[model samples]
Target: MGTALGTRSASAVIGVEQSLPSDVVVDISGALTNLVADVFALYLKTKNFHWHMSGPHFRDYHLLLDEQADQVFAMVDAVAERCRKIGGQTIRSVGEVARRQRLKDSDVQELSPGAMLSELRADNVRLREFMLHAHALCERHEDVASASALENWIDEAEKRIWFLFECSRN
Candidate 1:
């Protein structure tokens, strides 16, 4: 299979002018898995925050969380599609995502607006690091499509981070 970005997985052997090597697929797959897992992790945090948020910013956060969820979910889909392109299988279960994802699991109960915002901001910043690494890997392979997707992901994530900290900036 192949990601929508036009990268496929097999085995990585970077030599010729035609066809990606099978071993190269393995290398790219490893990198893509990291990307996919990162998106899945961030996805859970946003959705969890959406469901369990409380306090003064409740309505505002609710709407923001929805937007965050949509963004992360779209990224997750792209990541999984990358897996397919690289001849790897996507991690399909929430349970798997929970186990595989590196983001923290917070108890959403009784969290204040400030608390939730802090958590989201931290998570997004961490995710941006992962995106940077993934983007670098994509570039290493000359996978322009994957790199471009990563750029978009970083831009969206940066906006969410700005939104989370908007109040504090004042």
Candidate 2:
């Protein structure tokens, strides 16, 4: 990501280098929007879990939720940085998050511990799906590096979501 360091060659895809194609630029815009949706989902779910969770595992769950919130906040930067790198506009509002998010929303106040896990797992699944779709989009545009990154993220999301969902079942 260093501007002065190892630069990948610009392809037909936009923003990879100077004179990026218009369609690629637009595609980057859409990707950024969806990524912000991801950020919103991550933040909301973390807060929900941190507040609502209860059980014999309460302390563990609480700490994990806090950790997740921090990690997710950090990722918000990565996603936003990707948008900036691609010369696309980043999402600026909860309204924009709602508009662009593929993830489902839930009412935080209404949620119980079990419900929090359920909704968070659902969002992670949604994110996994989005990453897969993004990977396919990159494939069509012949953007192998971007496709690879998306595929990696999709796998990680699926694995984490599965763990959270299974914990809820027990």
Give TM-scores for every candidate, taking all chains together and pairing residue i with residue i: 0.81, 0.78
Clashes of each: 16, 0
Among these predictions, the greatest TM-score belongs to 1
Candidate 2 global lDDT: 0.68
Candidate achieving the largest lDDT: 1
Predicted candidate 2 versus true structure: per-residue lDDT over 22-73, tens digit per residue: 5765785578568768767778867767877787778877886776677567
Q: Candidate 2, residue 137: CA error in Å? A: 0.6
Q: Judge candidate 1 against the unseen true structure and give its global Cα lDDT, from 0 to 1.
A: 0.74
Cα lDDT tens digits for candidate 1, 21-85: 56656676677776677777777778887888777668888899888889888887777776566
